[model samples]
Target: MHETLEIRLTVNERSEAVRIEPRETLADVLRERLSLTGTKVSCDAQVCGACTVLVDDLAMSGCTFLAADADGRSVRTVEGLARDGRLSPVQQAFIDHAAFQCGFCTPGMLMAATAILEEHPRPSRDQVVHGLEGNLCRCTGYEPIIEAVLAAADAGTVDEGVAGW
Candidate 1:
């Protein structure tokens, strides 16, 4: 049996120390240890993007990341995006555009979209599509997701659109 490694992770906005086996995945740590189950684990191989989360502001697959690898890194899941019960712009855009259907893919989509907007605050349609290419939504057919990203970029606030709600 491999010895557990003491790892410290800044999750959401709280600091926590967890003992993780060297082989344990970040997704497991987040779900099983911290109880932040919003970060779903679908493709353990890291292709589906269903396990995506923000690591140091970059979108990364939790399933592919070792728990120890996240030591000293700030992790943000979908649960962290909002403040005081208010949804973030990206999240709000998703709601406004009706971007999700089953909602299983929304977390990954939001993570990817957040990363994309970090690069291009106001991305073009093509750029939006390109940025979100990594995330897959079997239900929405990609149209609503694209529109939601654009809408979030445009409205400048997920709750307040370009028209400033």
Candidate 2:
């Protein structure tokens, strides 16, 4: 016999009530249960930031973050970065700077950048580097990604059109 718990969470500005097992991770629940695949699961050990998502406005590793911990909180995934069919500033900057190659790490990078921008408003290059140090990306070599983040900060509206704050 297995035990399950029901949790209510707000994801991407949408409320979701789900029955989940005690051991289920937030990444699995979000990807499988809610069909939000943007929160990718790479190194489930939290070494890589591929599974990063904003939980209550703070960046968290979704793979290691238990679903139960997300109950009663607001979650913001890569899909929630935009507003009204428009891409968030960070997302647009990524595209403009060619920040991604394989694109697997784009979602996580974007999320991390968004979180940092929200917290610091205008982050320096070193601050951006320090903030995103946990995220690993082999495709774009991080130069473009860093530039994208800086450009996003320069846009001065990184947090304007986002959902879930």
Candidate 3:
């Protein structure tokens, strides 16, 4: 039998404990164990940002991140982007701007954008581009995504409450 380790972590502002194999990736744990499928797993090499999730308020590639590494830390997936049924500013911006095409990369883009907004409450266009450079999207040519980030910043939606998760 494969050895398993108990992992305790905060997910979407909720405390959770689960047993996971040492080699399991964060994406597998979140999707299989926790049932948070918002963080997609693709390009297992971390080249595609589909598995992006926020770890301690920083954007991380869930596909390549070990579940054990996330123990005792906070993780926020796409499912956590809403509060009390209200969409987060970043999420709203994506919808308002229609930032996604096929939508396969939306989750990662949202997580990365949220991190960017938290780090730079009022980021410039160039800054927004630079912040999301790690995340790739084959749809919308990125113009709408960039616009959405700018719009979210302009709306003053970046707040400490959103960053806490």
TM-score of each: 0.92, 0.94, 0.94
lDDT string, candidate 1, 1-165, tens digits: 779889998998799999989998889999999999999988788788999998888889999999899999899888888867777788998998899999998999998888888788879999998877878889999998999988788666333433211
lDDT of 3 by residue, 1-165 (tens): 999999999999899999999999999999998899888887888887889999999899999899999999999999988888878888888999999979999999999999998899889999999988878898889999999999888765545555442
| Clash pairs detected, candidate 1 | 89-158, 155-161, 155-162
lDDT at 95, model 2: 95
Candidate 1 residue runs with Cα over 4 Å from true position: 157-165
lDDT of 2 by residue, 26-123 (tens): 99999999999988999889988999999998999999999999999999999888877888788889999999999998899999999988888788
Clashing pairs in 3: none
Query: For candidate 1, which ten residues in a row score worst on lDDT?
Result: 156-165
Better of 1 and 2 by lDDT: 2
Q: Candidate 1: global Cα-lDDT?
A: 0.86
Off by over 4 Å in 3: 157-165
